[model samples]
Target: MVEQADSRATSFKNILLLIADDLGKNLGCYGAEVTTPNIDKFATEGVLFSHAFTSTASCSNSRSVIYTGLHTHQSGQYGLAGKAHHFVIFDHVKTSPAFFGEQGYLTGLIGKVHVGPDYSYPWHVRNESATRDVAWVADQAGEFFDKAKAAEQPFFLTVGYIDPHRDMTRSGFGNSEIFDARIKDIPYEPSSIKVPAYINNLDESRFEFSEYYSSISRLDQGIGLILESLKARGLEDDTLVVFLSDNGPPFLNSKTTLYDPGVRLPFIVRNPKAAVKGIENPNMVSYVDIFPTFLEWTGKTQHAPTILAGQSIFPILEKSELVPESEWKHRVFGSHTFHEVTNYWPTRFLRTRRYKYHRNVAWRLDFPFSADLYGSLTWDAIRHSQPRGKEGDILVGQRKLSDYIFRPPEELYDLDEDPLELVNLAVDEKHKERLLEFRGLLEKWQDETLDPWLYRDGVSKRFIQHHLDAGMIVPDRFDLDLENIRIR
Candidate 1:
């Protein structure tokens, strides 16, 4: 990583990671009808990755993938980190923060530290808050930056913004609450917002989206405030800035599902060392690759865990198009187990450049909704909206309401033909070989990651492999046949 020729003298090396909660590709830079001047400015100067995807749509699991170079199923953070859910990362796994601290760097996190067992994420200065007060978060970040300068050590700070997520009460996004005066309120009207394709465009939905836009605008201001402090401290040229969202928007068909709108998110990286600037890289990358990318940036892979499941993407930091190189596979995978403790649905997926394959292990059961989505006004409108048919029907986005809840076991989508992923090509006779190839790829990934949800004869093979090894015979199939239950 060579630093390009510049007039400004670079002093310290650091990393500033900004993670926004429940934000999708609805920013002004993404060509959405939203006003985010601050974020857009950075996007103009950095590489805005158009096809970045998270390993899971659930927030905590998604964070785990970013912290450790592994998925939630392998890292042991399979669900939300709330006390009721109590999902914690495995103690044995080494997180990025821990590695940075070991290498004599000052690690700090402010606002929304969701992944825990607290010791696993041993930030040197941890000020975790859930407030949407972006200005206050910027203040804490400034103090941390000052501390790093005083200690003469490089800093690695992660600021998790709680904005843009639903207020969990209704169709609100903390707009009703008061905040620091430095946080300017950039309000939007429902008529000004354009709802995404994954959501039904209704009156209530539009109103809710307008509110979400307000929070996103506020988050952008907070980022600008923090970046200003970094520049004031003469660290702008010496730091790598990574910005992204945890998951998709908090909507019915997006949030907890394996759909593209749920996992595909806005990711931008502003590495000062890059020879080029403002490169719109089109390669598909995953959240699990984040830790490895950070490790490569800082040369901190010595103590990294041997079981890390992602490769560093730092080699192709400026490629505008997908590379034909073997190292850059142009593929990513997803793992989702739980959002809340009660919402248990294990799913895995493999996405290539043009095709996506989904394996829903719990296809027999209805997809459970997150509490926040269940109470939204958008959902209210969706349930009551009628179809113009002699036999009345309801639709969520372009998908049938029933299909959103009760899904097939195997789903394959050609994203080029169906960007919305409304068609199922898994059972199509023409794409049978394609489906089999992707299935094999996903199965190999599951085996490599040691996923417990890998199934055989309607049972988790990882849990029941002992019984089979003890001279017991079992059927070599995924689903069980009730008529042939006595097979030896």
Candidate 2:
């Protein structure tokens, strides 16, 4: 509501955050064959962050990190929401929307409101659904923009597009919904697409990828409508626009895991009256950095720098220059404790510009499968493939079934040489120093975050409890497993 003529107050009065569900950097802007022209156009007019990442690859948990500026460990949204698992954000946590509401901005969230207990993230307006009807969602967003303008209030809006996410129907992306006439059905040819190395290039994968691309094009259409809404309302010049995805595609080895295909995201930010355009930044940024950036942009940061775990990238967006070595983040971290209720495999990852390391806490156990990935067409083909000859006919996407199921305690990859992360250099004597260095960085980060997942003698301290002298329930948020039980 601050209508001063000061440049800061004038330039960034509103915020529009557009989040796509289960999407990765597979857009035409990112050199992928998928048609995301609207988002690609936004990237061309905005600052495209080449190395943005999510702290977790699961849906609700990643969005929680973005909204709360906290890792899953800190926010307590350990997995998906609204289930028996009920991994809601911590009670004391202040979400991004709630903070903006405090600063007199009308906060509105349309489409996939995946994370909650209503009290935790109190968005002023909530229109939640699983519909891939992007146009309908855009219409709702346009209405929100109009309302905010009428009230003469600054607004923060998040439109979560449910496109490109797997449909409930098998081998579908919801592209055939006749009710969604606003989205034209654009079918992709299976043979024309370039399959990423992380996924198999089988007929089933190709078919499903076609559906995925079709859904992505629909999501792009929604982006265009929302941008039009902003411009029509005359808020385009005053709104700080950000577009990203909650996680990766709903395929095996991408959505549930912390691999590049899973965690690396497409982040485009079009700051109002920015100094640069179409600049690709290579700085290491994570979803946790988002909350702080919004706070800084709106001049609503009340907490000390120590409280927020992320550093604001407003300077980067404003200048588009390489941040000084001291100010730059050389590595980003991720934690994936769960995807669905049953997928309880805990893993932590640290990725530098050159190398990536993953520490699988439950390495002895086979990685549990998420329900969607287990039932995917891609997985079906990989699971049922037969070895024809002595060479084994290039096992499922060139990865052995055993390797996919079983994991070593530590994994290190030189991403420059192995972008696909097919090679594990953890045990290689030649890369031992690099592995140890990355591992040390990861452990240090864990300690700084006070992550209960920190292991001592191979057991996660997350299960252990302390301060028991007070009462029966000892009250610790980090005890996610509820292993600390005092006999009643």
Candidate 3:
């Protein structure tokens, strides 16, 4: 018993993960007009990843990717895991908290435990409470830290802050609530904020943007309090702290879609023991990389190359430099199957440094909306706005509203020229080579990942778990003629 305890004590000890709900890269550190001083200072004290993305834009599916080191399609977390949806992670998957528990770390989750079947994420301290109340969340975290300190046991705690996500009422981002009497909410003027280019400049959008900024400030305060607690307890140097969001801001075109505004979010890491600090990493990183990175950092990973779908960034953190000739450093892939149960817009994307390609499987159907976004004041404004020149034309950003709702089967964007993904480069004759190259890359990735969504004859036959008992077989090749799918 003594030997076991000593071994555990000698291993890399503490990990603190803070996740913000429905927040994009809207911090002062990220050049946004938001008051996120605490988070910006935290980035200044550590490494800030400039191009981190999620596999999916939905809350639970994205969290599942971060926890499992697998994409949403691989993990079977198709949509939100709220009671209404009940979409859970695949039973066989091993979650991060569960894995750490086996390593003798006391795993704790403070706020929203969204992705679960309780058995999947076996957190020792599951403190699900007033997530919007930053002060309350901090108090709970302090108590957990105190407990870990008393026991002298290594700890891994995840605090999910449910801020910036729209509240029950329309246009409410939990800003009106008095979370704590001592913590006053900072007011943001609508006219002064920089509206995201994805949404039209409307009065409703400005109102919601101001509300979102207020919630972000509250989240920043929560982070500061938690960091202070760690410092006060003398665990500041030992703990490897990480801060990121589940997905993008809760709004149309940003939250539920595979656009840059949806998938590209902020990622900051602060570890005093590591050599890297206050540096910005411009490499492309996916949420899938986080799991293997954790395992590598804690010395729990096997020497053999992992099939866990993500390479660890431990080397980059240790040397304070980009990985030499790393293919993953230049590109990342994403799979988004669903948002809510009803919001089924299956799409796959391959995002490179200079380009992004998206393959929309069900391109004919009008894009469905999440319940919250559908009821939002921003959507109301867009829905009720006057139609422009044509019959189905309404201005949504730089594109026609119909174009936003009814998308093509494939989309290619030159990220350099159109950062907001305003132009479709797929049909451009000049960029055909780039489009085909990215398309081939996306297909290769799908095959490597064994993505079951590879379809033939408009059916995902490859995903069928059971084959015919006698002689039926699924073809491994993606080259299927749509005109003639022969049954031999």
Candidate 4:
């Protein structure tokens, strides 16, 4: 253990991780709706990361990356259901707590352990639990903190809340009053949400946007409760608090898509011992870096399990003058696996500070809307109750790919000009040089990462068919050669 003077002098620094499900930059602190005083307080007091991103967009894959410090390809988690097939930080790498636990620190997790099935791992703590309710999570966390305090053990507690995620059939939709009263005045209409010109502006697209904002407000309230509990327990100052979402916001072109809203998340870290306070860092940081950062903060000596794809932001947090400019500037690479129950294909992206490039190998397949399964049920039941005609038609139609593929195989977006990714510069001869540069970058990343199915859709297609034949998995609509036909 490489104990620093300050770290050893003080009672061990406890870690409190609060993760919200499907949360985007829609809070007051992030320049959007929903007044999250607790989160805002943490932002005001801590290091606010402007460019922090998840390795993947989907929940399970992103969480796995955060836990393991490995990319999706390395971990083998392509989507939510793929949790069973992958290696998590809890499974492969030495977890922050296990290392700290060996050093006499108590560790526990509460609320939403969606990483894998009920499988055992190296750092698995039997004390951890998960729940969808916010109040219950706060109570459980309070109890855990109290227990850790009683034992006089330094602690690492993770609290995950399932909010802002698309509401399940029975899980009552967003809190209407909270949305109408607190956020309705925000001048954001479904029409105001400029969808990419290439995207089909179906009626369902507008309704989805409205529902997404409602969910954001609901999640904010849950975060407020957790923060209050921490303060009541007197663990605020001693604990190094980190507030981040598991993945990007769930929306049409975001959650499963390799875009900014899908991968970029609000990262706020508040450590009382750090020299810097209330600073907005534009450095590109990934979830993988978190493992090393936590260890470094606690004055522990440990390297990432493999060559980490992420770099630590401890220097930025401490306001160290010795920190190099190169350390802060780095491109973030993102990957996505088969989302929903179907084999919708996979995509990989590279995002620099000013630009973003996407290489969708499975460009032939349509965007799979996982919410459609639940939405169809609701639409059918309330067909007569809600608006009819085009509005209802859009809501009830099958999830199909839009006409964006008419352009080019590759996509190049100047994030500065088009944050929403409205324009594709891949075919523009003026930017051919930039397109080639990013394409080369993406290809290099794919090869180096050992992406299992990169440019190998035939391999994935065969794998899916093999699984179906062997009774390993089954789909509603089975087609061995899906590339030749449009099932929906």
Candidate 5:
């Protein structure tokens, strides 16, 4: 299924952005024991990013980063968008659809449009459904493409596949339901599937992952079907096809946490006209870079009015030579405040080539769970692994469950030494200076991003900035200590 790329064109006109829900780096291209031939073929057609990361590990928040080129803290979609969560994006935030739609491009989205206010993402065509019938989704996309062809308008279509994400039933990833005939059911043996290091390899875990693999392959079939539509329309030579996941897998350690396994998901781009094709990019690219990259692809004539925070990676994508490490940003940052309305643990992270740092604002609070993760059979495996009394010895992967829930205010891991992020170097005296360096860098980012959760003396510094302007002084600590309570 590997189609040849057209290397002659200098730029792309049509854009196809595909987002997979609750997917991690489990594809064949990423060298995992899984079935994703279509996506892997697509990777060979252009570039595969080895170290791409989402700004947040939650679905709505991560998508907001892509749509607006701003962090969740910046976009105001601090949690889930549906039901009682009811989190909506700020009206002021300029979105991708708004940018492309204004320039007379035909924009559309089919399936799983999570981030909202509805008005902010003004897609010309939208059929939001949770159906795993990817062929039906492709049919919808083809219809939009046909309309675009009829109008002779360039198209920007996003297909958000609700694949591999845990179903509301919590039993499986919609694998029991029969899908379209065009979709392939890639049934994997539970013993053959590679269990991630972050979770225990219980029989229940293996079974769930097998289901997840099938759902992922089903999602892959949709990619091929949609590409066939493009091929039929002769858009293959000039279109930019991008594929990424909203977050990590729906397992316990991956989904809601700011850990590398959570945020560092697969990001593949198949730019047909790029000078460089079939290369694995090692740069630490963030989701924020995407909006600006697409804007640049729109060309100078379109005139992007809104200034986006992410820098365009067009140079790296287009040029024959790889962008020097000095030229590219080597680190990525993440912010996670909530998953659902009830899961409010504001944490920010800075991951560099060498080390990773996490600043948990509400460290005293027990780490809350996204409902799906809580109810997952995998959680049942972990929680009931031991007898009633010995919880401390119970390990969620390598880290203890108690340590996982009750984390320190700061955590520093030399990624080279502790790639699994097991040992907390923040509590060690040897790495104090290195920890401070990363902490300062993270705080500076929080300041730059206007993050209100950047706390001092148990309160948001941005929240009390006016008070500080009035010449009030507070402790420089992240939280208040009753022992050192400030006196007015």
Candidate 6:
């Protein structure tokens, strides 16, 4: 292993970030049953973050936070692929790539760059990349790296893979023919999969979970190829390689929700030159911390253009004396916006080490779990299962709006006991104080972050009304925001 001088050990001239779409803790390193030898190997040589999480659950929203290092409620992108309106991290400030480029690094992005409209940002080179073939991407990235090395310029390469997202064309929900059939042997049963009571268990749900495992394996193959390319080009030692996902698996109570499976992501960082190695850091970190951490790692201290809500992890990387847990146990927040044209469910979540609380603003009934208009037919079939008997008559007959109104508005879960978030303790009098405390904290965060959706009578209403006028959405029959809208 190449070691850096102790004085400049933290400095990195080149950085390579690999982001997998919809990749959760399915790899072998995170105790999943999937076969990800290459990813596991990488984890063994680097620091694996046990408590890393994203700021939002949806694609565009989470990517916005990752790029800008701000919460989704702060970035103003509460939905999926759509117009670039509201506040955006890239819009208001220079991105991590741009900052590194200014410091004499050639920065480029390969694969999915689903932040906003394609025409908005021009600073980074966006490659016309897709996740159809892992080998092809490895070959392309190898060529890019070789050219950058020949030019003698440090590079910031972001390889985004859209694997395992969804194959709406597939018959088995998330299954894709591109994946090796060996994935079928992975042990994942619906009976073994613990889900929340809010979601009805069905045969299709199990099939969907099985398909999710298959997709993860396929993406792992792509990651293997990328790592091999780096080693083949002899750039493994010099490059700071980081691997993570934008959000959790897209399933019921997962994607577009503030649950742990939705926001918690796999985070791994490997710097062969750094002093630290083979360590699992249990410290809690968020998407907001990435930009500042990258900046600090590159040996730059300039203030970012936008208001950064993240702190630098340079001290941790340097193997300094352990910081108090209270110092690092900061609250992480998340939010959701209009996912599809017709479906509107907005929610905010607050998470700590032991507890997680969710506040639903606009709930819907009879709506699909994921608003993936382009999702695979297999996923759709699994999500819309028929109720068995009159015992489920209420769930079977209600409209999406009615379901939303009847659902619990506040949810509190002790993550230590229910890592899967299967139980709710919000109504328990013993936990009432804790719920109120988190609610108060959430309200304070909302006010301080300038969340546009908090006040119903201000520009937020104007914004919604404007979208309504533009035919973006229709005022639903059970819209709760319209009834309890506060003028202030």
Q: Considering every candidate listed, which one attains the maximal lDDT? A: 1
Residues 314-411 of candidate 2 have per-residue lDDT tens digits of 86664455677687777889898987877898899998888889998888789878877888888877768744325564354556667778989899
What is the per-residue lDDT of model 5 for residues 1-488, given as tens digits with 9 covering 90 to 100?
11322322213488899999999999999998787888888888888888889999999999999998898998899999988999978888888888899888889999999989999999999889989999999899889878887666788999999998988876589988887887777898988766888887778788899999988988888988988888887788878888999999998778999998999989988877687788888777899999888887767335764556687777676433446778888788989999999999999999988888999999999999788988888788888863332554787777788888999999999889888898899999998999889999999999999999999999999989999999999987888899879754
Off by over 4 Å in 5: 1-12, 300-302, 318-325, 386-392
Instruction: For model 3, state the Cα shift of residue 70 in Å.
Output: 0.5
Residue-level lDDT of model 6, residues 1-488, one tens digit each, is 23433223224367889988887776789987667888998988888888788887777778777776677667666666654333234355556765776787777788888775443444355686655566677777888887676666677888888766765554243444454432333435656654333344556555666766666766777788888888887677778888999887765555666678778889999976877787777777888888888777677767554577788765665342345766665467777765543546667788888899987665444334554522634345433655534444323112232332345667788989887664678889999999989988976777677676553322354346567577654333223456656433
Which of candidates 1 and 3 reaches a greater TM-score?
1
Task: Give the Cα lDDT of each candidate.
Answer: 0.88, 0.82, 0.84, 0.64, 0.86, 0.68
Tens digits of lDDT, candidate 1, 1-488: 12332222255568999999999998888888788898999987788998899999999999999999899999999999987999999989989999899998999999999998899999999998999998899899999988987677889999999989998678999988899988888888898667888788888988999899999999999989998988897788889999999999999889998899899999999988888887789988888888888888877777667878888878777889888857687789989999999999999999988989999998898989999999999898888664422345578888888888899889999999998898999989999999989988998899888899999889988888789789777787677879888776
Each model's Cα RMSD:
3.1, 5.3, 3.5, 8.3, 3.7, 6.7
Instruction: Return whichever of 4 and 5 wins on TM-score.
Output: 5
Q: Tell me the spans in candidate 3 whose CA falls farther than 4 Å from its real position.
A: 1-12, 303-306, 318-324, 386-392, 464-488
Considering lDDT, which of the candidate structures 2 and 6 is the better prediction for this target?
A: 2
Residue 127 local lDDT, model 3: 92
Candidate 2: global Cα-lDDT? 0.82
lDDT of 2 at 110: 94
Question: Would you list the clashing residue pairs of candidate 6?
Answer: 168-375, 168-376, 173-378, 173-379, 365-400, 366-400
TM-score per candidate, chains pooled: 0.96, 0.91, 0.92, 0.76, 0.95, 0.80
Error of 5 at 366 (Å): 0.5
Model 6 residue 292 CA deviation (Å) reads 0.9
**Which regions of candidate 2 deviate over 4 angstroms?**
1-12, 303-306, 318-322, 386-394, 461-488
- Model 5 alpha-carbon miss at residue 46, Å: 0.7
